[model samples]
Target: MIQRHEKQIERIHKWKEDHATLLKRIRKIYIWVIWLMLPVAIFFWLFLPLSRNTVMIWFWSYYALWQVWIISRSKTVMWTHVARFFAAGIWLVGPLCAGLLWSIHYLLADGAASIQEPWSAIILGPIVEEIFKLLPLLLFLFVTGKERQLSLTDYALFGFALGTGFQFMEEVLRSWVSSRESLLGMFISLIYDNTKEWGFAELFPGYFIHGDVIAAGHHVWTGFAALGIGFAVHFRQKLGKWIWLVPLFLLSWAIFDHGAYNSHVNLLTSDIIIEFLHFFTGYGHWYKWLFVLSLFLAVYLDYRTLNQEKKALPLLPHETLLEPVTESIELIKSILQSPKQWAATMLFLRERRAYGFAMALKEREKPRQKIYHHVQLAYHLLGISALLLLSFLAVNSIAVENPYYLAGLFDGLSAWWESLSAFEQISIILTTTLVTALLMLATGGGIISAGFTAIGTGLLAKDTLANSEQIASILRDPKSFFKQLQEDAKEMPPQELMMKLFGLGLDFASRRIPGGKEGIEWLSNLQSKSQQFGKKAKMDGDRGGGGREGNEGTGNIPKKTVTSNKGKTIDVTPTANHSTTTSVPNPAKGTPNSSVDILDKKTGEIKTRRFYGPDGRAVRDVDYTNHGNAKTHPEWPHEHIFKWNSDGTFNR
Candidate 1:
């Protein structure tokens, strides 16, 4: 049995190595593709007479990317990983799930018309779409082998990508179906047809109302579900066996929200609730408010989780320390004075973030090895591929009867190209070549030399050019830059610096905009209130014995107080023997709210840990000291678990 276990571990390790290699190669290829496609995307954006639908698509796409960027600013996950997942949502999950939905409707419904009927849209649609949208997240967790290492923000980002992709595809299909255009015609219309009929209402459907569009959408819904999944996985051990139900509950809630929107059912039936939502959202979009609220709550939870996780991460070497304002100023200076340095600085920052995340992951507890069968992986891949192929065929079969054929469209284009005079063709080629070359050079060269050449000839701002050389010097040496950043951080209080920057921004805005001074005053009051609230919360936490002390004991171990769910405080103190013991405030008869953590003397590694509930039962117990007892515990470093009852009690 031991030999078999060893073999399994060996296989798991081998698979992980191979998977890492494959991912690295894929990342390299993706980077190349992004660079190569940049010019093409720009050319199309500039020259194409985009239809209303296409414009809306571009708008939503930009909005989604912007949201991802803003939310992931302080996150541990790499943007590239999120981008790959986003692409998957667009190209893979979106089409495959869509095809599946089409197939289901065709199989069950009376005809093509029945697919959009009330019953299907209200009931069947929500279940199928929600489940399919979640599949990518589940698959990602299974395949990555670093599920435990992932943060809540990471899961949310993945879900957002999937949801965005699905939404885009849905909008495209709606346009195609409504217009009764041929596949080829639909493609052409997306680029060449200039139609003004499609407005914000048509693009977003039920979301736009009262001259405003709610930020909540399909991405928000999926992100909420994904955050629940993250919570369930992260707290499974601490929260007991019942914690796994969180994801299911969230998923069900998402389905209900989707169904309610489709059926035009107002879940918020109370007048008070309706009034509150309308006043805040500036519209009577109850479903959108519910989704937005849920997403916001989930984000708040993610932020809390991030606070805890960040404490475990070591500070990165040579990390940029400039405040947001200073950083922006430096970036602008780099772009204007030296584009090459700007490019290098950007690359350096990207690498630095990636390295920080890598270090954090390395510091985490070693994960349990799981044997992943190649056959099982192959089956999953084949199943997904088959579904995609079948869906494509099914959708194509439905569209084939349309009048606008792709063959004739391509033929016309070919003929047009052939008929062009040599001079015209040369001009066209030269224009395209020049545009592409200029774009490549501008982006590649760190700064557009032509644009700078023009700007350099004119009067430049003295303030902007004041520290140009200094910025250039720092950009050249990342180590020096980071070292200076650390010094700056040490010299100035972060809050003070933040306040100074905010004041500068407010002053600048007040001078330029109407009622800006009043807005600034209101914002200041809000900030003051928020700070007071934060201070109160911290004080409460400390009073309740939920805060850790900074004072270090022997071997740099810190004494801390932990507050349990039952309002019990447990004081933990490190001993001379390298073991820590938790002392409960008071014992109720036989019940004890105590715990013990045995640590290795040399490495300070946890050898064994045990936690007792208020009911005197062992709620959780980890045994790394008994790995030799394979008969009892086949898995090394396994924990003895207790089930949590619905009424806040544990069942052993």
Candidate 2:
């Protein structure tokens, strides 16, 4: 075994040495990608919104090259790192972060509307984006077994790469969507489409919403803040537990800087900066200068930290090779080729540590990519609802001008509105909104993207109400909370737990609109009906010979019963609709000698028939049509002849 292991290790080394030429080619390709992308990016930036296709081409090309460059610079960059970073950024965090920030805008719209500058940029934007951005890094740490391994420099590099990817995608989205039309509005259009017949031209497309500015140095600042947190984490022992406070301060600074940049106003020393700049030159844009200054400072800090770390650890000769994995070297090869299969195996084995490690080995994300998935859902629902309102209004407007449209179900939209009860109106609004959104999703081309945006926007309201501050505090000591949840889950059956959750969801929805109590009550009633049906089904299974193996005579079938909400009960009896000789249900199997009287009341004639066998398949002759002397034991041609078969087959 030892000799075999040595041979495997030697073979691996030989393979690596042989692949040096290929590795060099790969490195050159990365370089080419970067150089090629720069020109296209610059061109797009110079000629803003020239076309959607051009902008997309530029952004993707730039992002791909930028990511490649970042990876190329690192000595220890691996295929795994490249795949994981891109997957986390492009697939997971990017869209979610955008959605989070968008939702915040709508949530705080009323308060923000009062402010001239973008309010979300200052408050909610920082919290949402920063936290969401941090999540990917944390996930990386957890998956890569780097929670303990990561140095401050590593943190800074990872943060920078991740933030760049996230920001680039965000820029692409902004370019694709119109500044004037919120994702919310786009979603609402679904409901409107039902009532109004607007041309395809009126619909907001990628072309109309262009010229989206991709902010420079924005992500660098955020990345720096993350790096500071990583530094704090690294030096927690020396900092005496108070190290955590450093991250908070750094994050706050990052947020303020972001807000200042986005709001286009200096948040810290606006008056002084403006005056100083104005004194030098009559033109004053203090925010732009401040943004530039902040970027410079963040970059400087990041560089200094990385330089110090590099000096301490030092890079390998090539400065870009993976550490030699031992023990399961063959397994590592398999994983590098097919990381997903390795992940599945780990999961199957219930090896948490191995699974996490394996997860970081490829381009895969956690199932819960966005913490604000529910928020997105809420936004989609809301957007659909708003559209429904607008569509109804448009329909009403048309009806007023030309009564032939509605034909009098409504005199106008107002008359129709006035006729509905509060509950009815709310029901119509929600149901119609949901239906419209689904229909739009099914039919529309760009609707999915719009829905994602709206859903992201919807998260704002939830985030505000939930309060990140409170959540942070709770998260610091989440043991008790998690324990409580675990206990609840253990105590409740899955079905009951699901019901409770559904009830809670309905409760949340009800709180949003007037007469929402009706919705909750309606849901409760539905649950009760469902439960009753379940009970009946269970009872049927219990009472009857439930399985094919249990063959009791067919005398145990339960009668159907219906009960109303008011306690009125109705019994239903089964009747034979087919032309077969059907037997009446009894408690037990029929005895061979037992006789039943077949009597015709109109003719006052009676004929007796003796049943034989468990199923009563064999019977003596009984013909009500004959006045007298009906054959007792009839042949095949007789009026009524039956024969029993042991195999449960019948013959007459």
Candidate 3:
């Protein structure tokens, strides 16, 4: 029965794995489809009136969002929350609050003029709009029950989305009424026009517009409040019972800023605040700078919190034996060299963050099924909405164009159609439809393949680039390079160092070396002679059998046994004064014996160590002698990595 139960559990686990694999495949296909459709949608949107304004807004908003995404260590924000909150801001919060405020104004005051009444715009409007803008996010937190799991950036992003959506709706309405040639043009004018003595300029300061009307306008206010909420939740332990006050204070401040702007009232005494800000910043926008400063502080706090959290989590498999500082430096170098590498590196970091989050969630006994479900639903909704929007725009563009032009084109086509028989017309229509569908499929497949190829090439290029410098150095001076390699071999495993050296030699030989192929032949012959000499010396000493003194003269090494992480014991032998060789017993049958070598050097009181792998192949190498004041004091270690090829050569 126990065996049966174990078998059943195994089957269940296998099924889950299969399900996960299928879901991953589906998600990839969905992402590819989205990418393919995005260009088409943008093309359609461009044909619509005021589309440039919408595009510009999206560009700036996403740019800011990207910055937030970068600053965040752990990406905890769900796409579902982003889409839902933004949509709610557009369809629910914006319209509902605006309509409610209008009703209140109509009841209290007279006509269109009452819309700008002090009670409405100055006090009530700010209070209503600010609270309503946050309602969707509050509801999201309550419904999802992810209040504790969320990062500060997640909250800020949600707030930014909500505010951006609300502002989008407001701007659309204003643009429709104002008879503006382009909203983008008007925005540019507001920024550049210093001569226009507009009352709205006082609210934003520096910019000749109202704060809430500009791009990232309402985003700044709402994001500030959301950040406070994030801080309060994250630091609940430190704040004790007063945690609620943090968000409340920030929310009140947002409302006050809105109200003050609307009323044209200066809360600060005289121009003291303005003058102080001007003296320091050379700009009189104290409010703007304060908000900016708060965002920076929030990012710093989030980074610190993430670092603290990471300390408790187990290291990733790749990170276990590798030095993180060294790995990061290599990653940065690769990123700088290639744009593809930059993208791949970012994706890798994102995956690592996801893994970290998964581990953290597991430790907390939290189920992520709901989050996954939400993400899928959001993606589907977004995909459907985008398709519908694009379809509508395509139709609308044609419909809104000059009827005569379209009619003339249609008449010509109609005449051509009339010239053909019914059978020919049917055949042509079918062929055109089939061809168009095939072209689209071909284009999409090509795009998806290209993306994958680019990613793979980027990773491959990074490895190639790793050895390029060393190969270049070897080409310049093989003798000096070989001498350095000999010194490194003393500290590193013999097999690993030899594989690296062999690989570098092959690369050097392939390049335009000083002595060409003859030089390589000479080097190979020299290595063979050295090996023969060592073997002869060993045989002579063994034949004499003169005990320890004879063994020492013959270079007989002293061996010590040490246990590996796998709980297997391996013999470590010092073959030379500077080098020690560690023999690793192969776990699998029919495999060659694997060994590692470590070289240690002592100078006066300071010691330097280099570690290598059991197979004499190193994924990374670190040198500690160069870091800090190594001559006077022991320095922090640095690493060098090499990729081992199946053909007994180092790839890097």
Q: Write the per-residue lDDT of candidate 3 for residues 572-641, one digit (tens) a residue.
A: 3222222221222122221112222222211111122233344434344333233334365343333345
Question: Candidate 2 residues 66-168, lDDT tens each?
Answer: 4323322211222234334534554577667655544544576543232222333334444456556666776554444343444344455566556555554
Off by over 4 Å in 2: 1-75, 101-117, 177-216, 265-652
Candidate 2 Cα deviation (angstroms), residue 531: 78
lDDT of each prediction vs. the true structure?
Answer: 0.44, 0.36, 0.44
Candidate 1 regions exceeding 4 Å error are 1-52, 72-74, 111-113, 176-216, 265-312, 315-652
> What is the total number of backbone clashes in candidate 2?
4
The residue-by-residue lDDT of candidate 1 on 79-150, one tens digit each, is 445555555665677666556656766687664555544444544555666667778777766655545566
Q: Model 3 Cα displacement at 640 (Å)?
A: 37
